[model samples]
Target: MAREGRQWSDFEIAVSDYLTTLREKAGEPSYRRLAELTGIKFSRLRDIFTKQNGTPTLQEFIDLCLTFGKDPADVIYKIMKDLEAKGISLSNIPAQNDPADEANAALASADNGVDIDAWADRIKAEDSVHEEQP
Candidate 1:
């Protein structure tokens, strides 16, 4: 439950979507039955199914994957690799208490006044000077 509401991270959405597919393949078992098999409460399973928990806990994810006869590592690796192709990762999620500050910090990092273009130009000028010397 680290994240919730409209701010669901890509990782969370991916996990939820993956589990949904797994559930479907496993005959779409009832939450009650899943609870009995997984030892996770039916209510919690419902929340996970509805995505009300934002993202399932690592344990819950692993348990569900196992229950569905899927390998959690394989599923997670595939999902992470796909997300990585899009330049996204689970680490991108901000803290729960005050995410605005974290977002603002990311924005702030873009304007740190380190002018790379200027440095490149300077390096080019130095290279030309060295060429003239040799």
Candidate 2:
């Protein structure tokens, strides 16, 4: 079943092409096997490769790439580049925040080398003295 006319985004086109190449390189294994390996539905795998489905969900896309021994991150980076080229404004979320100077200074000002073992021993001794009093 050929979809003669459908507009695919650059990301989709790139992903589809890469998947096609990988499929070919692996001697074109059965879609059933691909589904099992990727943990995706057999029908969905078939639909994606056959162009019956125009777009794959994020999980499907990632699983397919990883199942084929390809890094999903690599493909995702390409998609990011493609989106950038097309002037798509994606939110730039960072994995972690850089520590502020104030935070660093506060940490530096705090006493870090307090003897935890001595403090614990002293607390235990104080607790024993209280228990004896009662």
Give the total clashing residue pairs for model 1: 0
Name model 1 segments beyond 4 Å from true. Answer: 1-7, 86-134
**Every candidate's CA RMSD:** 11.2, 8.5
Q: Runs in model 2 with CA error above 4 Å? A: 1-7, 79-134
lDDT of 1 by residue, 1-134 (tens): 45444555788788888888888988999999999999999998888887885458889999999998889989977888778788885576442356888776876687588776887899999999999994
What local lDDT does model 1 show for residue 122?
A: 99
Residue clash pairs of candidate 1: none
lDDT against the true structure, per candidate, is 0.82, 0.76
Q: Over the stretch 6-94, how does candidate 2's per-residue lDDT look in tens digits?
A: 56665676677778888899999898998779888788888788666557778888888888888898877766777777776545633
Residue 108, candidate 1: C-alpha displacement in angstroms:
32
TM for every model, in the order presented, reads: 0.58, 0.52
How much does candidate 1 score in TM-score?
0.58
